[model samples]
Target: MARWHRVFRRWVLARHYRFAREALVPHFFDALTAYALELSRLGVPHAKEAVAALRELRTLPLPSFTGEVEDVFFSIEAQLLEHWGEEVAGALRRGLSRNDLDLTVFRAYLKDRALLLLGDLLRLRKALLARARAHFGVPLVLSTHHRPAQPTTLDHYLLGVEALLARDTERLFRALSGMDRSPLGASALAGNPYPVDRRRLAHLLGFAGPVEHTLDAVASGDYALELAAALALLGTSLTRLATDLLRWAEAGAFLVGESLAQGSSFMPQKRNPVVLEHARIYAARLLGGVGTLLALNHNTPFTDLNDHSTGVLEPLSELLEAGEGALELLWVALEESQFVEERLLSELSPEVMASEAVDLLVRKGLPLREAYARVKAALPGVRPETLGVEREELLHWMGLEGFFARREVLGGAGPRARAEALSEAERRLKEDQKRLGALRARVRAARFLLARGLEDPQAEEGQEGEVG
Candidate 1:
């Protein structure tokens, strides 16, 4: 019983408290400085000394506290009092509440995680582009409902996968959009009494603007849910791709590289696609995390509470980490895996082109139903030469290479269409890279300013201009 209690306390109770200290204390110290500076501007006595003390204390290691306190802020408060004396350290909490501080911490955590996830997604997309380009003309059968549906090139298939992930990337950006606002000045579900410059705090924190409503800012859990939802969707995408790769490899249509495969201990001929299997498991965990987070927040009072705090947010961190791992593993798997061309062609199932054969007959002035009926009346996997068209015409309509040529429409799995799509994807990736670079620069500038104490509290405009 004692062991069980210890396990629960260590794993469940104090885990996020530790996480908060490590992940949020640095950001909190900067916020504390901003609050102190604001208090000074309001003619609060000795605020500068307190702010200076807080800035100096920021250089010290994060405080380690016993498990008696479930919240990191209390531990931080204790540490501040010990170092700065009562008078100076007391100013740290002048116009802020644990509520507002928590909001900022959670937002900052989500913002950083979202950006990191975005970076991983971008790299995965880049890997897909590389694979697509490498196998530009490699033909394979396109599957629908778990069966061969049509002929398509490997590059075209990879481009389609990239398109799905591109949208996932956009959704991640949308999650970041929701996190762009700062919740610093929303003190305990109400506006701070001190003349605080929320916009300046937001700028210092690398947020685009301030969340206007104090109550809404402190109470909102929708941003976390949105991010979780997006991450779950990304996990879904990875799962589908992983499942397809696994199925193809199992069918001997795709070959997993030895670098990515594992051999069983006793099974001599085993070449297991362990990476893909692990990718699938990671994807499932991401989805399961979403469910856990949703349930944790469900029916809780829609206000500042422990339920939606660090503990709830911790699962999201796990999910995002899992998501990043799944993406990276799948990217490596895709990059190393090869298509068994003969096996791929053999599985094409000549009957998969029966519809195209019917289309040929229709163009020759037969009714749609009549064309389909005539084609169906014939034996399964009928030779294209036996169709009511000239040999050259039959090849044009039903041959693997010719099938791709006929699909010249935009977004089609044809040579020209895929080439154009690949080029466009590359261009978009370059643009996204620039955007990410700019964002990181802004964050670095904010960290730099925070580390050095604010020289002029009123220099908001200049400082904001320097960032972004």
Candidate 2:
């Protein structure tokens, strides 16, 4: 049983340890420094020794440890005891608990990961906008329920995708903002009795501020859930884009580049769109990760349970990793893809222009249902003469350029509306870029404070800038 437990520890719990070492350890060191400094300021005993030990420990390589130390927090404490003796270790941990410390580390780690994912999302959006601009007025047959429904431009379709992703981007930013508060001073499930300054701890660790309620700080997994929800929405948007690209590629209206294409092993002539396929697969995995997170947090007592805390770490990390992969794959796919203009134009059959024809008849003083009935009866071989319209007028309505020109309403599929929409999309992209820059700047300022072990007045002022 002892041997079995050791193997289980090595195989099953190794990732958790690695995550702790890689993602949480640096932040743990910073948190310890912040706490020691706060204690020194408050005239706590042994605070000076704690500070001195941490400074030296920072200079040396992080000590290695065996997995038998139980968890990352304990391992760090054990190392502290081994290296600096109980006086320094005990002083630093005066009011600290794994519950609050782990929560704080998780938030810090997630903030960095969220920033990276935001950058990838922006890159994908930029790729989409570039493609939309290049194919502004190219004609394509828009479909409803897998049948040709109307005529639209390639740019319009691409912009629809951009709009979806734009919302996903907004959601992700909101989630990141929601999780920005520090949870460091909420020792265990209640507020600690020590006079540690929570706000100072927040500043040193790069958080907006400490969470107001200590109980809520330790108990709430809503922030993690919010992030998972945002990722799930992003996955949905990516899947839709991939699905459309796959369909269009199969229909010969989209040309997948050789670099992104793959040849089937047995088939001699197959340029499969493997990038899009892989993107969709990654999206699926992201959604699955979100589901796992939801399941972990479901129906459990919400007071500092592992179900909502440590249990969520791996799933959330997987979700972020999957989201990153999907974003990158989609970006590359979009960059390497092209609209087959000839194929797109060829696919726009006369039936696709039927909606415009019906509108033309209604404008010619015919009742709506009567005009629809006339156009319906004339189908399967409808002609201008059969519909009792001038040959030139029917030709104009059926023409792709004329089809785009006549529907000049705002948000319509007309060229003018599309141009307006494109301009608006460009403006929103710029605003989003500015917002992302501010977020990154604030995080940098916080890291600077953490590294210096003292708050800079200028850095604090800079961190005061709001993301909105």
Candidate 3:
């Protein structure tokens, strides 16, 4: 019997029991309370005994049953049976199954994790905005295909990156919102025949409401997949941003602060921008995590299968943690770094103003073809005055500052545009904070109600009676 138990423990429970206990215990207890209330409402003969068993189960240390049982649910079941006997313990199983229970706990666990990831994203966005403001009006030649295409302020680049992260924030929120509905009443693949108030369970469990379809509630893994995809795209964007920072660092266009730089052991003069490199590597890992999650769910059965179970989702939280770390480190790197004005200015060739010069020539009644030829021929020492325009009159189309001012439409690189973008981002961030704050508050309130039920299920019963 000892050997048999050992083998069972090793084969089925050893790997995931810790995570299961941590993730499911509180939700399981709450589910038990809900079940007890539901049974009492139905006037079951042994509802009080079931409630007593739930109280006993809560007092027992979770780790004490480490190898004594295969899973927490099973452990709780055995403990309840020992304390309240089969008649009372059996009542606890009426409207719940591991299928729905696992999904519900997963939802609770994922809600907290998703909120943490959102917090990290919000912090990263703020960091990016700070960098934008710090570098406002600082000119840098924007590149396309490794060639200088146009001139833009450094803040414009920073805000553009923030815009990408804002989409990631939205996607994370969407993924979180998808998890709002509860799956607690969807026992196994269908649902229980017993009278169960799924809405009560959802309220107690911090879910917004009960998931409408019993089968779909147990079957769906799309929330996890969508979150993975969104995070993957977020990593892709961060990788691109890191790549740009790395290239600019290499070209001497940007300088990393001493704290963000690493030195080679063999080389005395090396101050490598390894933080950005680490960011790139972390982004790659996030993408890999996304691919793994997708593949895990791709060919699997839809209903409460092993592939879509709680154990399968254990590493997903780590992926989110990794993304958070990557975003934070990259944000710090950007915050600490400074652009090299001389080096950036050195790369700005007079030919970069060729487009504006072409437009001016067209205004002077020159043919487009002739204007293009004229601009090309006068590349090295090209000035607006050389093209039959007054020096002061043409000054508005000459340098990097003029180049920025010329594109003064909304969302452009001009000073006013960047200022407006910054103000708008601040407004959006305030809104996001308020929205997420409300969500956190709701979860907090739900948990408080659950804790009260754990203390005295009758108190919860009275409240429910008043509501009903």
Candidate 4:
């Protein structure tokens, strides 16, 4: 082999194999065990010894194999052939191909990582919820188009962020659901001839069920794409939040804890919110990875191409790992940072409450356009005399608390509306928590069954389990 070819085999291929070793190899062996037991049940030759040999293989340390082929599956088979001989290796390879096995392992690996990402996301959500509750009714100026538009409570802004993340949570769950099916029995993009029970294989591997179409099982990379896209969407939301926090930190309306902030080397007064900056970088990497994955899948044949399978795994895994880091940093920033309430109130433009002033004139029978025009005519200062209202009433309308008080309509910033919104947010948070908990429980149970099956290949036969 050429030097670069040898290097590729030694580094790139070896790295991928190591990842497989850590994340999916055990699951692959579990599937093989299940297959052997199924073949034994069907009285296939060599099936009985295959199971014992696989049990022995699992007990030994996985050997490192960097054969000239540059394929991890081939390397594994080579090891099996060398260690367990032809009869056992051939028996396990019966009706199996690298195409199906690789895809199955990829799916299993993605599912496991997705669960971990989901856990990180849930923690971030919980932290944001708690922060929202803590800052309830604390006033701040809401901005649009980079300018102050109105007054809103800190909790209201945080809740809006939570709502966006809530949608991301649903998308993640949908992606996980898309990946729930096992592709184990689809041998080389075609249905296997052996009487192997596909559903049993899925059960032993913590999958919800088997993919129905054999070709689709191996050919479809849409599940990985869906997950990447969901992570990208989540990255967008986090980027926006990070941007907002950066702005707030710059304005001194939010304080990054001293431990989280980085001081300038030369500038005496500079304290950079590097935590948010790093979080944004991680989010950008996620978005970039999504584009790379999409481009890799583009223009490729849809039938079990390496471009869509092994090719996307590294980038996808990096995206998930980056997302986890981003979520953790953001959660820490949210929990540890403090809002400068006095600075927030002091920095608000007095005219931020002008919308309430507009509403006041409309309530007195002025047309909406006329009320808006009258408020616009007041320039930067809306004095009581200029607006033809008593000073006391005008002051009340222009005050932040009064501004929030009068907007009692549904979804408004008024106390009643804010209270209702908080209650609804709390309800949604609790429901999401419950749903995540249930999903985690299902995964745990399925993993338990899979481990037990590995321990004794026949132990989980005829047992029922489901995971998604």
Winning model by lDDT: 2
| lDDT (Cα atoms) of all candidates against the true structure | 0.78, 0.80, 0.77, 0.79
The candidate with the higher lDDT, 1 or 3, is: 1
Estimate, for each residue in 1-468, the C-alpha lDDT of model 2 and write its tens digit: 243366657755565677677667777767777777767666667776777777666655554445556667677677779988887788877888878888888888888899999999999999988998999888888778987788788889888999999999999999998789988888887787786678877877777888989988888788888999899889888998899889889988788889999999999898899999999999878776667777787787878455347669878887899999999999998888888888876657777778777888999999999999999888865577779999888877778777778777877779889999999999999999999998889878766665556654643322221111
Give me the runs in candidate 4 sitting further than 4 Å from their true place.
1-12, 68-70, 306-308, 452-468
Q: Find the 10 residues in a row with the least total lDDT in model 2.
A: 459-468
Could you tell me every candidate's TM-score relative to the true structure? 0.91, 0.92, 0.88, 0.91
TM-score attained by model 1: 0.91
Writing each residue's lDDT as its tens digit, candidate 1 over 1-468 gives: 233366666886567667877777777777777667666656566677777887887787865646655567777667767866787667767778888878787887778888888888899889989988887888877778877788888788888888899899888888888987888988988788766778877876777788989888888777888888898899899999899888888888778889999999999999999999999999878777667777877887877454456766788888888988998898788778887767766667658888888988998999999888888876486555555667677657777777778788999877888899999989988988888878777777776776776643335742211100
How many steric clashes does model 3 contain? Answer: 0
Q: lDDT score, residue 194, model 1?
A: 66
Tens digits of lDDT, candidate 4, 358-405? 888888888999889888888687766777888798777678777777
Error of 3 at 465 (Å): 10
lDDT of residue 299 for candidate 1: 82
Residue-level lDDT of model 3, residues 14-71, one tens digit each, is 7567777766687777766766766666666677578766766786777644676667
Error of 4 at 424 (Å): 2.8
Task: TM-score winner between 2 and 3, please give it.
Answer: 2
Model 3 compared with the native: what TM-score?
Answer: 0.88
